[model samples]
Target: MQLLILLQLTIYFALVLSIRPRQCPKGLNDANTPRCVAMDGISDVEKNECRSAKHCCIGRNGYCYALPRKVVPTIDPDKTNEEMLSDAKDIMRSIKGGARFLNIGPFPSALLPYGGEDPYPGFPRLPAFVCHKRPRFPDNCDMEDKKALRYTRNPPLNIPYCIRIPCDPDLPELDESRTKCREMPGCFFDVQLRDYRKKFGHSVMAGVPVCQLAIRNKVFLEEARKVKDKTGEWTPYLNECLLDTFDEIIRTNHEGCKTLEMLEYFKHKPKIAGWKGIKEYDCYLIAGCWMTKKCYYPVDVNNVTVSASPTEHDDKIPSALYYGRPPCQKFDDKNAKSAIESYHSCLVSGCKLDKHAQNSYYNYLFDFGKSMDPSDHWVFWRLVESGKYGAHNLDEYNLLPKHDVTVTPFSLVFNYPAKPGESNLIDELLRPGSSSLLDMIKTGSGLQVPPAHQNIRDRFLEDLQGIQTPCSTTFTSFGARPCGPPRYKPTGVPNHCPYRPIEDKDLKPLRGSFEGCCDITLCYHPKEEIPNARSGAATYYSTWSYWTECSATCGKGNKKRWRRCIGMDQSQCTGRTTENESCEIVPCSSWNKWSRWSKCSLTCNSGVSTRTRTCKPIGGFCPGPDEEIESCNSEKCKIDRLFGPWSEWKGSCNPCGKSIYRSRECEATTCNDDDLYEIQQCPTGCGTWSSWSPFGPCTWDFFFRTCQKTRTRVCNGKNGRPTECQGNSVDVAYCIC
Candidate 1:
């Protein structure tokens, strides 16, 4: 009976939930909206009322509200408007088609340092350039000729923040000093300067839209932490690598001391002069501190300790943050606002800030959802809410109570020092009675104490009175004490007289202790023999004579000739007893005799003559000229000659066609005595001819009768034309014979 009642009550509750209407919040006037968007372990609905409705929005306090809507009117196009609209559509189509055009105009230069005069001056600096065409917004929702439109709105473009800002950050403005090209001190490494043009509609133009470069100075800072392990302990192996690299960096680049001027500038001025400069500055800070192993503060503020647990390590200690100083001073709940204001003011004043203030500012600029406490959470959410409502634009996001400054998480990592409590581990162990002498020694050299020295403590105490062993005597096997000689002699009987001059090959460095010898000053050194030894049986060797003449006269020459004896051992000579030397003879110089004189320079009159010679050695100095010159004789040349007309040829010098000679005298400036002559043919006079022929000799043919006719003539000359009538030939007429 109880089971049946429970089942009936469950069915009743299910029906009530299914039939119950969702109650909307007070500000909302919806009939079917759920009373609560989320239920406490009761429902599995994925979405809530505000999220489902098109004209509703969620508030920060987790309440849903209906949003007010305004109607917009449509436009009717005029002729001019229609034409412009068509052109705009065409341009948009072209841009989408990947057709690019030249966008010629002044680019925003405010983010860069101004080289020209500043027009505005004050705390809230004015923009270097204001767009006059678009009065309300300098950077409108447009780039060049194209409107800021996207192919799809569902998946937004992954554009960088500086580019997405409503007002172009690239525009020239006097708002704050910025990084200039001149201030960059090093080359860009792993740096990226993206145009953000692809995301912008007008970026297809010739000029890529300008945006802040993505600086990778943080990469260097990242490399700085690679030596640290997941546990945050800088192990021995890592220490070795870090120390060696740090030492090398310090040794090579010792310029760690930034000028006070530069430090003050960095501290007081929030704007950087150049992206490269900022990166170089970061590199300088990292290398310099790592070189000294001294960067240990949360804010990199001087003389403070910073310890952050690795991401993998849980908070073994119950603390929100770890730094040189607490994030802020202890405060009664009532004075929170005043304390916050003071902290904000300190940051603005360019004073040293506690770790919390610094982080608060960084979070304001680049919030990566890295919050450590409820207070930080509140600050981040407020900023996000402000952004959603458009109450503050992106450009004005950073214009809070504090002065504007740019910083990145990358630079902050360099300030993390070795983990807290680990730096002075050795000092803690060195406390009195903390470790035994043996343990200290073992730890010092990282080695074990030998068994022989295990009882050193007891032995040292027992022998505290004195050391009884004699200083200069050793025990013999027969139980006798052998004392060292007051003065000692060399091992073998002293080499009799003269000592040989030492050569490098024969010399041996002294080894072992130098102690009690009979002749301490000259223990192993033999004495020099008197110049002419009186006895022929003397043992010492003599000094070497002058080196013999070189065997050859040039290049590498050698000579060998000498001898010596020591203690009558002819083949056991120790030192160099022979002489050898190398020599080179300089070559002599000579000159070749002069060559035969060259032909005269000119064919007529007097002309110059020359001769030449060269020294046998090309570069050798000579006392004679390399070339000589003298005058030579030359014959006179003739000029052109003129000629006079010839006299008429003598008339027919020979009457019977005989040849005759005709000559004429001609004169010239140089050929006055010379004459001209020519040969000519003589004219032949007329020859006699016979009388006319008889008519009876005439004959007739079938075609015409024959008629008698005859004539005879004499030749005038060979020049005359030939004819039958003139050559004594007869002229005949045949008339139908």
Candidate 2:
């Protein structure tokens, strides 16, 4: 049973190792390690613990890696729940306070005024409802006493109020047809007669009686002309007579006659049968209609009395009369005693007339006089407005002062005074002052005159000249410098040649000149040959030779050899050839004929035969080919082991022995076939040193007057001796020759 239990434990251990903790049951991993699992399956207490641990862990990690235990204290469940709750409440309060400090409260309500009915009745009054106090009145109340309260306020009092009440519907409506009158009503004549008497007074009735006669004449003439045949000339003649009579009557009586004539004429005339005549005789109607029709009544007055009061002055006399031939009344009366008398009386008495009365009298005259001349009314009306007497019969009013008048381009004439406080009219036909001949001369002569009398022509010309200079003025003619004849020398002129002399202290010289003469020609003189001080003497000759020697010896081509030859062989030996008598050619079998003869043999006798042979004639003779010979077998001679210690001779020689020659001490020479010398052992007199004969010594002269020897001396070197030892007295020495 124990083995089975052990076996089961072993199996469980293996399974745990094989499966990862993530695949294991919850909380089965090491207790020290945090197990991430679903919170839903855990108890509330466990979840709470886990959350607290998580918060603590997060807080510790955030605070620079402090352990969770150091950052948060362990919970003590033994403590009362109230303590925990109180701590929690404190934390919540801190969070809430922080939120409040950040102004994170619910968004503030909009600042707009609230929209709702007012809680209290009329709490805030509208601007229109506010009342303003009335203005104060004066203590005496003068306006009130006169019932002139209307002017007390800034704008007048609204006394009548002028309220527009709607029209009354209950009352009978007025007939729109009655608004316009086409014909006279039955009561119109009576109304007009009563109104005429009220307006003009009883004296007007006197004119009315005359006016009726004129009316009858006018009617007869009109009817007579209409009824009569076109052939009868009497009718026209009678018509003229009747018209002239009517005009006479109208001239005598003005307003009252004109009114009555107009009424009767319109009443009787066939043309005006349907149209209503004007009952109230307005002066405008008579003036306009009579002037248009050209039917002047005889009794029309040119000037009537414009009285102040009609009732008191009904019998007053007229100021003037209309009288001319028959029908047309003269604007100025030539023969009318009453009209003349009335005008004289008006001039004598300075009487004032009412405006309406004056207007009525003028209208009558205008109607009567305008028929003769259409412009008469316009001229007369202007004169009346000017307060001047315009009628021919009346005295002149003369209201305007006397003056000379100036007319502007606008046709408005200003009355300038010839004397102060006086004026006059200028005629329209006159020319403007600018173009007037009189004005032109007065201005052009340049005469000083009064301030007001300066003519426009002079002023205009002066202004133009002030702005523009004379035509002759130019840049050169003005005070400016001229572009004159070319200047002989530079001169200081403004913007022309304005250079000033530069002081030496202020000016810097060019480079490389102490005395400021940097020009090469000015500073340096031309080169000339230098003279020799010791001329034509031995010292001069020797110096010249020395310089020439250096030039020749140091020149290219065997410089060292040439330098060695200096003073040693001032005369170089030239090679000469004479036929050598001792150089005899004998047959090889008889070569031993001469005393110092060398044997030339073709073959030897058998078994070393000893014989002192003379020059013999052998059957055949032989000669060897040419060979090379060198004195010193240096690299220049192209012979190996021919120089240095193994040399046959050690000094220079005139003629070398055999195929050998001296190069220098401790050196040798090589032989060639064609060489003159044959190969032989050097004699006892020749030293065993190399480099003999042509290879006497290696010496180089570099630069001028300097000689160098390459080989070291084996013995004490002597001058003028070859580099070999011949006897005890003559040791070979390598000297630079």
Candidate 3:
């Protein structure tokens, strides 16, 4: 029984050894020789040789050993439940403050007014509504007065007819419709009258009625013609008839200044129109229509009067009809304020009064107040506001000593005179006696003279050498600087007369008209001629030029000829300034010779030596070799042993159950193809089993048992299959009987 138990134990141990997973040797793998090797202090060749010997290699700082068992802790759901519940309680614990308390609130309401409402009643109240003010015109203004502010003039007056019918017996009767324009006749009349005003209006200052002059030209010519036919006292009758005809025509065809023709006709009547010679009518023609109250015309007196109460002294009058001072200027020391009031009353009455009288009054006042003090500039209604009279000023205080300074007058000094050539008025008024003529002359000199005056001056100064100097082209009638070439004749005589002779050095003497012969040598000189410019052409000087360096160093290089204007003068250099051409530089390529051969790599046969040469002038290719090589070895090298010391012996195989074996490790280099370790057979015991007994008597109730037998064999670490074991055994199984 003991032997049988020992045999069973032996077989069990062998089965455990055979079935367990195989392990590698210290310095090698299962397919290699040694079981393990040192991780550090080993050369690559040593490591490789160790691996070839079937050894397991340890990594740096680690020993080759079996892997540890995982031993993972298995979780029991019942044991962990309490701990998990505790963790959940910690996570769900309430914070110091509730979530509702920590949350932000909605935005605050906007600021409100004192009563929590707006001051204005409307919605979307705009800034303009709160701050802006509407504009309004002045009170006491009539519809016409208000409308006139924006009223523009009518289209240009087109009067396609003769202003005067020819005084001829063969002439046809005057066709009023064809000869007169009744539509806006005042506008047409103003235009016709203005033309004559420009030409002959100056006669008014001399007390010459324009109407008389108008007839004199035609009547005088007719009278001269009739003289050949022996007419007697016909001139006076002809004049009376013409005057009557004129007065009737004006009444039929016009209004406003058009009535000036009537005034002229009346003033020139056979017995009523002359003041010693001709009546210097103290009135001017107003340029536009006038609206106002009618003047009171006394029947016996036949004159306009603003009087409220008349006394007997006012009735004592001359038999000859006489016009009084214009209502605007009728004011005296006693009546100044009352007269002004009366004038304003008339201005605002809105009645269509005779514009002729209003214009006459305005003209008289304007003309008379011109020479007064600067503050009195507004004493009269400025003619420029002919259509706008009384539109703005309605107050009693503004009536006198007025200062409507913006009004521009042609012949009157409305404000202090401005600088010469200025179109607008300035604040500086000329003093009564300060250099009036000299100022006039100076101011005139700044303006361009009329063409006739210029021609006259040019002719008188023929003896001088240049044309007129440039002067301003602006002039007022009162202040004109007539042009003059020179104020002197060739002999230097100062003559202030028209059409005098001028002696030229090379031409015939020419006659010229001038205001006065003033010495003009200072005003003109011979024109200077430019040194090199004839007829204003620019002059230039010569330039210098040179060729610059080539643009390239090898092959074809561009060379440029650069030219610069000499003396910084460019006008003379007009053609191409620079030029380019191709050029070449000599390419002298060179290289250093090869250096002496270096020492051989070996002292014996078959070694090699090398030599090298370098190219000079680095850019271009070199013509010789840069390196050379030659054999240098002189002898062969001998081989040496490369195997390491043998490792410690490993365990002998299965000593209790089979014959044992032992082994040790050594390193094997590439130089030799041999095993890295040696093995030796070890001696050990092999137990045997006895044969089993045959079945005795069969038990009636239980199956009968049979005996088994076993045998032992040397383990050569080979032939471990069941068939081999069966072949080696004397007995293999037992039977049950």
Candidate 4:
């Protein structure tokens, strides 16, 4: 029920999710731009006037340009070449996954202080980046470089948010930001202008639709999750699979993020959500207090002790655990926006949102369970007010009344800090929600069906076409660069590397003609079509064919690889002709085994009890199936089978296909939206026939004197297509007219 409510309550999530292009939020608009002529009905004179003044930035950029930024070395221009190389090397060394000399780039003007003191710090900050410029920047002689990568502070420029496949907390620095083609959106992931200026030319096109790019991202995540499940970490196989998945998705929209059927399938999926800007997404959904600068959540979630009012002092207390101040950033940074974009689930609330998602509840109008009382169901729905709900949108906290903070359920989505005696919030949330943690994927990882790319509908192409002039790089006028690609191009690289550098040797143009650029990433079996020759034995075994694609995108599906015989001897093909692998791509709602007919409610205790199995999901009220069982006053008794309702009808009609079908949750359980419920017969492109009247009394024709029985039937033509009832509405036999 909660899931159903969430689906409906979030209007945009329901109506404009799948195909809508990313629209510039009303709050994010710039008046100096050409929005005056934004309306389709605007007069041509206005359009011309607006074009002369400025390109409209009403969600779509009126201009498309990839003008390059001036190159600045880590060291000053006056420094020796050796010094320049040395300092840049140190900066690179500080990063983890991306190689120091290869991928690290355009450093922030000033380095953010190392976050050694962050409440939940990962490995101590390493000093390799521009930290050399900071006063008293720590350094080690025989050192490992980790400096300059600070999570506690925002960078001068937007750093694309890394795509987290496995949710590794220690490797946030290694996200795909560096792997991207240098100049994004305009450059598309196809090429990086700044990075590849010397090697490959910068000419590229964002011809790929944002929709397709989003789908590729989703496929990578799905493959990433699968690889993690098997290897416990990222692997060459994962990268290889990613490359393969991308190639496949580009060809067929079947496994895409926006497939017609998949959108519907994912509407009820259990998603891992969190407030924007935080690193960890799987935090506990608990009540917390909000302030303009900081949100006060408990360090210990299981034993949450946060009060409505918390004294900002004494960091040791659970209530005092709040987000420490991050480096101040310009309100218009795209990195922050990317962080929010990755979690399209949070976009509606994020529109015009600030550095963090604090007062976003202002956008919503519906009443929700209040903070003071979890059971305050008497609340009524109301629009937040006529204005944007972002930090920039408001000059002070007064713009968003403090009292209104407790209204939306969003207050419950805080990032809880972990302590020695404290339990993990994620574990707590997952305990009752998931059957297996392995089935889950990160919220922002573009894998969820509808809501995944809901907000990424950047009608980039539409906007580009609207303006007659396309993005052509010019000397002075730089076309508006698009937001970076939401994901790294899935060409298969190592943790911190790009496809060209870490790709498979065999996959290269000349197949490893150059060194250090490619390696051996491929499938385990590397199955291919059966080779023609069997060299040695009388009847050698034929190798297996490639595994077929999984049967289902979400939920359980299967794949198979098969082999055949070489010679005339069929038996020699040997061990097995085929192989089967089960794939639970993404889990769907399912019932757990019915609890032993309630032993306490007492059937198992020799009294009448009920057996029930709940529909498993993180959110929403799942009504369990209950059946009364008799204990027979013994230790055990026969349990009655319980069932849930039938699922929606699925299947198509015409060309001798089943019109529709439906299945219910049974067996051990409880569970139609079309009923081709069988393939009986084609509808003859004709009207349905009604029963004929009893045979007319026996009558004899005057000429032949033969007694004949006659019956009449009616043709019920439907939808004004009475002609479909071809022959006639009535049928007669033997009797003269």
Q: Write down the worst ten-residue block by lDDT for model 2.
A: 535-544
Models 1 onward score TM values of: 0.13, 0.11, 0.13, 0.13
Candidate with top TM-score is 4
For each candidate in the order shown, give its overall lDDT on alpha carbons.
0.29, 0.24, 0.28, 0.28
Least well predicted 10-residue stretch by lDDT in candidate 1: 522-531
RMSD of 4: 42.5
Ranking by lDDT: 1, 4, 3, 2
> Compared with the true structure, what per-residue lDDT tens digits does model 4 show for residues 243-278?
322332322222211222222243211111112342
Candidate 3 stretches greater than 4 Å from native: 1-340, 347-356, 364-372, 375-737
lDDT of 3 by residue, 422-514 (tens): 432222223333334334333311122122233233322221111122211122233222121122112222233222233435443221122
